[model samples]
Target: MEKIIIIGAGLVGSLQALYLAKKGHTVEVYERRNDIRKQKLVAGRSINLALSNRGWKALKRVGINTVVEKTAIPMYGRIIHDTEGNTTYQPYGLEKEAIYSVSRGGLNQLLIEEADKLENVSFFFEHRCLDIDVESNTIIFENDTREIEVKGDRIFATDGAFSAIRARLQKRDRFNYQQFYLPHGYKELTIPAGENGSFLIEKNALHIWPRGNYMLIALGNNDGSFTCTLFFPFEGEYSFESLKTEDEIDNFFKNVFPDAYELIPNLSKEYQENPTASLVTVRCEPWNYEDKVLLMGDASHAIVPFYGQGMNSGFEDCSIFDDILEDNNLDFNKAIPEFAKTRKKDADAISELALRNFIEMRDLVADESFLLRKKIEKKIFEKHPNKWMPLYSQVTFSHIPYSEALNNGLKQEKIMDKIMAKPNIESLWDSQEVEDEILSLSANA
Candidate 1:
């Protein structure tokens, strides 16, 4: 059995530890913060995550899907509320397919607990990573009392976006790194459950209020409350910076999100009390140094949350690594570099797709053209399942590589542009001509 040292006990770290331990590795997880289960979670940081097929596959591999499922609320569609309180529902997939809303802290704690139950696994909280000796597979950490170094046969740094291990590697030669911060920032609020423990809105759907420059989204929690997030620019006419007072906060919501404004009774207080957090896209190359140390999850590629794939992608990393390990006969020397080469492209693809989705979510969801296109795509997918799948489905409902999905999505867009351009197309959206045309175009592409 190999000695594996994992940094950060967040969602990715905890899940990876479980996977490694199940593989008979002696695993030790070092976390920088206090045990999350013992502390009240900080707001804004505990953003609800969408658990999709990729994440499910990972949890199933570890045989803990049922444990996490108890806390998950399934969302089958997006419920869009317009400025005038009009609502529209768009199903995410055909029939009863749905994504799940899982609390970040809740899921992380559950995974940690499961990992702790394993004989080969150990967790150390409040142990901050100082640096790493990459060549020797050693980690230097500072505990409450003193500093210590621990060596492992292999090290996996799942330390999140701003990883200390990744920072140290950046100083070395040929380690490409770049960070892009979006102008937008996010804040959290709540739509509390009604008296007698009932949901205030449709409990099974994701609620969204999509204005041009900003949007508000709410996902259901098992406790009958909804975790609402407001995504807006840091500075603009309608932004977090511009809403300086109680009146401004009130008026902005009253005008832009009238329905949500009514649901959130303490909008003003939550607006002022909650902190606004920035969004960043982090991309780095050479996710490994030799065969001793490797980066996984947000440490290698941190993406904006618009696509709802952040946690799903990280969990998928564990699944993919497990496959690579088995394919290489449990050989770390062969698996490490192969993983870096194969996963990096998919990571970059998701990063770009997530950024693009921010625009679609914030602005295009309410557009008539966009909705019409969605209708046509859904019909096409329903009729010719073999020929076409919506980009969203390919990303969320399947385990296809993000790189292939992005390329195919672009081609599908080109074909869709032509299909939508036919005069009087909306009136004949369900016609056989449209179906044949889509199949023909897809075949040609």
Candidate 2:
């Protein structure tokens, strides 16, 4: 078996290590942070991730989905909170359909442990990759007091959005790269379980406090604590930059997300302590340097977390690359080229979908007209499930190509725009006339 080198022991890197190791290769996963399994904070975790069908499929391929399922909490719909603390529940799909909420740190550690079961899989903690020589396939890593150079037959860079490996490759001629950051940033907060580990709010739904320009969402953990995140603008009249003092922060939460503010007793403290992380979308061309080095996951196409596909899409990359390798007889020359070319468009599609979803989640979810549109769409979907799949369902519930989903969504959007433009659309959204219009448009789609 060929020796392989993988960078970044985050979720994608760890899962990729598991996949490659099971292929009977000597796989070394190099991570910058110390082993999370050994960390005290990793005992519980931070920012819980939403694992949809894509993520579940990848994990199941590695034979660990069952274990993951045990720790996951199923969220069948979105429980949207209005300014007055009233909630509107919107089911994500028909009965028994749901997305899962899983702890990022716990999942990563589990993946690492499972991969460690294979004697060929090894992890080098605290070894940060500094640079790489794409020509010779040699990587230099700083470990403690020394720098170590390693040469492997194949190298996979799963080192997140700001990857050290990708940074080095960006210096090459003819390489294309673009990075864009949203005006908003996210800060993670927590709502601990009640005195007896009881959920303070609805446990089976993803809770959202949609406030037009910004929003706050919460996902529950098996430990009964809810991992909450606030997506706020970095600069504005009411933004993170303006909320400087503790009073300003607390008062902001009280007036904006009163219900959530009451639930999170440590809101001000968490707001003060947690750093606000920026959201970025990364797009690049030719996610590989010939067949020697390949970039997967966020290293290639990092997207915003608005659609909750950042981790899912990255996990999907591992699965797709694995398939390409198998189909090409485990030859890097054949597999890498195909994946780089074929996966680029899908990654780009999801990036756009994610940004669009941000607006829908933060603004449209609370609008009356948007609600009417949703009701009409849902009615259409129920009547003709085969003919119409909502864009969100298509992205989250199926393995349909992201490019196809985006294209189809665009068609549906045009049709819906036409329908919504009709006079008194809000009053007649459920009328047969509206249904016929949607049916005619979707039939072509």
Candidate 3:
């Protein structure tokens, strides 16, 4: 078995180490932070992530789906709230099933513990990798209080955004990269469980309060509380920073999310306590440099959290990487480029789509015209079950390519416009035709 070094014992890296170790290889994981499982609460940085079918499938492949499912709260739809506290439930799927609400820290801890169970898997916490010697295939780490070098034939970087490994690879002219920061940023706040430890809203749906240019979203936790993320533009007259004072935050919450304020007794306090986090999308070409080293997860493609696929995509990356390796007769060198060439387009597509979805989530979902089209689209799906599926369905529920989903969505939108223009039965979509088109579109995908 080959020796492997994985940097960053975050969710993806931890999972990778477990999988590789199980496959009979020696695996060592180097993490910059303390062992997450030792902590009682998650770090107060990122909001909870939504894990859909994409993420579940990835975990299922490693025989941990049941464990993850136990921790996840099923979010069947978006419970939308208006300015006056009017509420509506927008179902994510036609069926009763929904996307999952799982804490990033909770999932990471679970994976980390699972990896530790592997006899061949070893972990080094508080080990920060400064750089890697590409030629020697060795990692230089500042472990706790001292610098140490570890030798390995292969290294997998899942070091997250602003990845040090990706930065070093750029110096070798091994790959092209781009990082784009959205004008908007997200700040997380909490609606802790009520005094009796009860959930304020239904525990089975994602809750949203969309206010024109901004949106407040909450995902349920197993502890009977909801974790909310407030997304707003970076520069504006009424930005996150602009609403500084307690009164300003109270007024903002009171005006836009009155229902939410009642559930969160100290809304203003929480807002002030939590720091605002920025959103960025990372794109890179050729995810690996020879079979000796490779990158995955946020280190390779970090998309905005709006689409709720950041972790799911990263997990899928591991699945795809494993497949390519198996296909190439377990030849690491041949597998790396094949992995890069095959995965680049899909990765790029998701990054773009994730950004595009921000507009739909924050603005368009609240628009009447957009809602009308969405309703009609749903109707089409009912009439033509096999042929008509929403773009969200394809992306979240199916393993369809990001590019194909966008193309089909655009096509459906055009056809929807034509149907709206005519308002006649003749203009109604033919279910079989729609099915054939979608099938054809995804056949090669």
Q: Which digits, one per residue and each the tens of the lDDT, describe model 3 over residues 274-341? A: 77789988888777877788888899999998789889988888888888888988787888778877
**1-445 per-residue lDDT for model 1 (tens digits):** 8999999998999999999999999999999999988967653336788999999999999999999888788899999999899999999998888999988988888999999999999999999999998877778999998998999998899999999999999999999999989999999998887887789899999988988888999998777778899999999788888897999999889998898988898889988998988999999999998888889999999999999998899999999999999999999999988998899999999999999999899889999999999999998888778789999999999999999999999999999999999999879878888888889999999
Model 2, position 38, has a per-residue lDDT of 94
Task: Kindly state the number of residue pairs that clash in model 1.
Answer: 0
Preferred candidate (lDDT higher): 1 or 2 = 1
Which residue pairs come into collision in candidate 2?
Answer: none
* Predicted structure 3, TM vs. truth: 0.93
Ranking by lDDT: 1, 2, 3
**Residue-wise lDDT of candidate 2 within 122-163, one digit each (tens)?**
899999999998888899999997999999999999999999
RMSD from true fold, candidate 3: 3.1
Candidate 3 has which clashing residue pairs, if any?
387-435
TM-score of each: 0.98, 0.97, 0.93
Which regions of candidate 2 are displaced past 4 Å? 42-45
lDDT of 1 at 101: 93
Best by lDDT: 1
